[model samples]
Target: MQVKIEKLDHFGRGITYVNQKICFVAKALPNEIVKIKVTKETKKYIEAEIEEWVTISSYRIPEVCPYAKICGGCDLEHLEYKKENEWKREKVKELLAKFSQIEKVEVKEIKYLSPYHYRNKVTLHGAKNRVGYYQPKSKNLVPIDTCLLLNQKINELLPKMKRLARENKVQEIMIRTSNDEKESLIKISGDKPKSLIDMKDITGIFFQEEQLQGKEEIISTIGKYQYYLSIESFFQVNQELTEMLYEEVLNEVKKVKPKKVLDLYCGTGTIGIYISSEAEEVIGIDSCSSSIKNANHNKKLNQVKNIQFINNKVENVIDQFQQDTDLIIVDPPRKGLDKKTLRHIIRIAPKYLIYISCDPVTLARDLKELKETYQTKIVTPFNMFPRTYHVECVSVLVHN
Candidate 1:
């Protein structure tokens, strides 16, 4: 089948109509014609892989990764950075219009964080002979020597870690680096190593056994705040961008000036801790016990008395939230908020709601439902992950 690419989709895939239905073609560019073999067929849209490109966009550039087409880590690495950001803005507006019936949404151009070597965290899957990211949607591993998205320290550690994996009984390895580049942590997840392997520039080494025993942690600080990181807890991958992202949330808190705030899906209390001084009181909640523990530890580390961490799913513990909470900030996972949580939130109906979403599609979907009792205020997009299709947004929703 031949399809003329109209625009880039959220995943950086080309969008063009085929047979009176939309088709998403991978590795095709806008204003280009491509011969494609259908990879997937569904009622709504068809997915295809490019077989031959009759024409290509001028913005398409040389991909750094040899496995860029197959590896799922970096989706937009082939496109020029300038065009990539514009496509991201267009994608967000498109999703918002589709979900909220709101067109012409003002989407700020993503702040250009460094296009490469910005990622501070990377998780690689390991098999007997290969170790790298999973193939697009499969368990098969695509061997990778390096990823442009990772920082220099992580790239330096990759060879040694891969060598160790081949030598030891390794299932998975997670590498995390601090913004200062002074602190580095490596987590092994199949069989716990008896002792830390001596490596250059490593501050801490952690282990997590397959039987769910022998867990370890490392401490990392962002500016003045301290956060404990574990194999289980969630932490932002880009450190410098995270500070700006947190600042965005803090700015929202300042504008709302709510007396009390609820930070739902709060990971390690980073946002709550950052904005604790602004609000009279802040309550942070997450389902991960490890993250909540770290959050509480961070609360003590920061020595903020008004903030507290609750180790419970936000959806399950909505009734437990203090009635005095006039503000709510949600930093949910890629899946976004659930229906039950949304309903409970509507029942409580805080005066101001701030949503920090990595997935724009889910954010738009949730915002559509949130529009029931809330009015869309402002949405700002942050280029948290620069060379990828992922774009983060801070949306402020005001109570009606």
Candidate 2:
């Protein structure tokens, strides 16, 4: 069926009404008439895939990546980068207004990092005689020679790493390359040979089972901060741009002059410690025990106090909060905060909520919920992960 797409949904899907119900069609752009195959039928909406663009939009362009449509790694490669950012801003605005009922959110210009060669790390799976990312909407893996999103040094090393993994009879391997360039980590999982431990070209860690089980450190650095990152720990990928991103988030905190701050999903206490001096006390909570231990070690290493790192789920820690939190900084995973945590945040009702998210769709939906009792004062997106459709947005919500 031919339909005129009216707008881009949060997932970059084109939304058009059919029978008074929304239809989400992939690979269709706004103002474009496209021939679509209805892959799904549901009570409220239909899911479709674009068979052909009957009339292409002006914004449509040739995607650079060969696997653009199938890789599922990026959805906005066909659209202009500028327009993508604009759509992201609009998505945030729409969510805040529609979901949160907060009006007039001042979304700042999206800060773009290096569009290419910005990624320092990538997780490549091993199965069916090759290693690559999983295909879109399927567990089927796509064999990749190299990704343009990674640094040249990392890309240059993919083949070698793959070879090393195969040679060691490894099923899954995660390569960690850093901005330092001098050091990199190769984590081999699934019955890795001990000979890999003596490899001179790479610093290796072995895992018998899951990716995170046996691996030790994932060394990473941002600005002057050098982190002996735990294998399962969270750290920003784009090194050069992370400083800029953190500065913008800190900029929001500085303006607020928060006394007691609650840092949710505080991976290794990066943001909490970075802005520790400004706030009188900062409490950081995360589910990862390794990350919390590192956060505590980092606190001692930096000789900074007044920042408490707790190894507990945010939901559990929320109940223990002193109810005197002036600012709440929440940086959730791509899935975003669960309903229970969202409810808890509303109950706490801190003066300011500095929300950082890598997924715009979730960020928008969460902001909508927060807008019930809070006003979205500012929304700023940082291009932490460039050369791809992924974006990291920061929203500041203040109590009404």
Candidate 3:
């Protein structure tokens, strides 16, 4: 029952071995001896939930949230902020070394942003029995007063929003509040559209938008540049760190002064348009037709002519990639880049490759394959989703 946690995993769970079998222990800290209840057991490893801390580690601190264990919103709330940064830094290093085997890749340091209230979007689900996020790995929903990671406005609006949501006929209602808290829209997707007239507190526009669809451009600004983001377009959720992320990517892209730049998986052409001024010409590629349309609208809104938005898969447009491309920036979803797309980028062999990833495991795996043709110059980790296991990382690679 008593086990010593050895290290932290990608999902922020502690790793320990019981009888030579690895066990993923949740709510336990490294170098801590704790009693745990076996939740799952397999041939290779076991899964456990901490029962009690027989001997607490020095690194352990009282969690800020009373719902730390029950609520699935945060993973590292129990650990100290400084220690969290150290563990995250080690996480990226281990993933890169283990998956990519890139010997000399220098991960500068894991930058720490404000851990609390860093998230811009919180997607709350409404089930038949309850209304909240699903428990860790189970479908059981744990109702809560507020999620600490969400912005102050969203946290304040949860109860009213929940009441309004219950009045609606739809089972799942997703509320997305923009960074500025200017455009607070709720999408009641699904076949059922019910009247929300009973709720008196709920304000702002109701999108009534379809799932995986886009609408008219919504104006958003980061630093000096203003962007038009479609309701369905994918953008970084953290506002405080958005400018920092774009600056880091822009710094890397401008280092090469690329004549031609490619933005793959470009959603609404936010990044392409933001960095278009640095390059002679920029091209953005995406599979979403609506996203491409929004990207074009964004370009026109910004009055930028150098960046071109194309509606196509990254791999499909690989053939159209000019050999003279000097820089390529990719901001892929959590699944990371596919093998076909990664191979295409390698084949193109741009002078510089900038990859912005939200998942470390996939990023590590892709970096391994890319190291054969490119060398990493810097690996910068940004805290996009704080109070959670998710992290956004930027890796700049130069053609070898």
Question: What are the candidates' C-alpha RMSDs?
Answer: 2.7, 3.3, 2.6
Judge candidate 1 at residue 41 and give its lDDT.
93
lDDT of 1: 0.82
Question: Which lDDT tens digits does candidate 3 get at residues 119-175?
Answer: 666676666534677787787777767777777766777776566556653455555
Candidate of highest TM-score: 3
The deviation in Å at residue 198 for candidate 3 is 8.4
Error of 2 at 276 (Å): 1.4
lDDT of each: 0.82, 0.77, 0.78
Q: What's each prediction's TM-score? A: 0.91, 0.85, 0.92
lDDT of 2 by residue, 1-400 (tens): 8899999887788999888789998878999998888999889889998888789999887988877766878777788777887787677666656655555778788887566677777788777556788876677877777887877767877787666555655566676666775556666666555453444445545464334333355556665565666656787888678888788878888998999999999998888988888899999999998789888878887788899988888987686665588899999999999888888888887888889988766776787777677887778878776544567888888899
Ranking of models by TM-score: 3, 1, 2
lDDT of prediction 2: 0.77
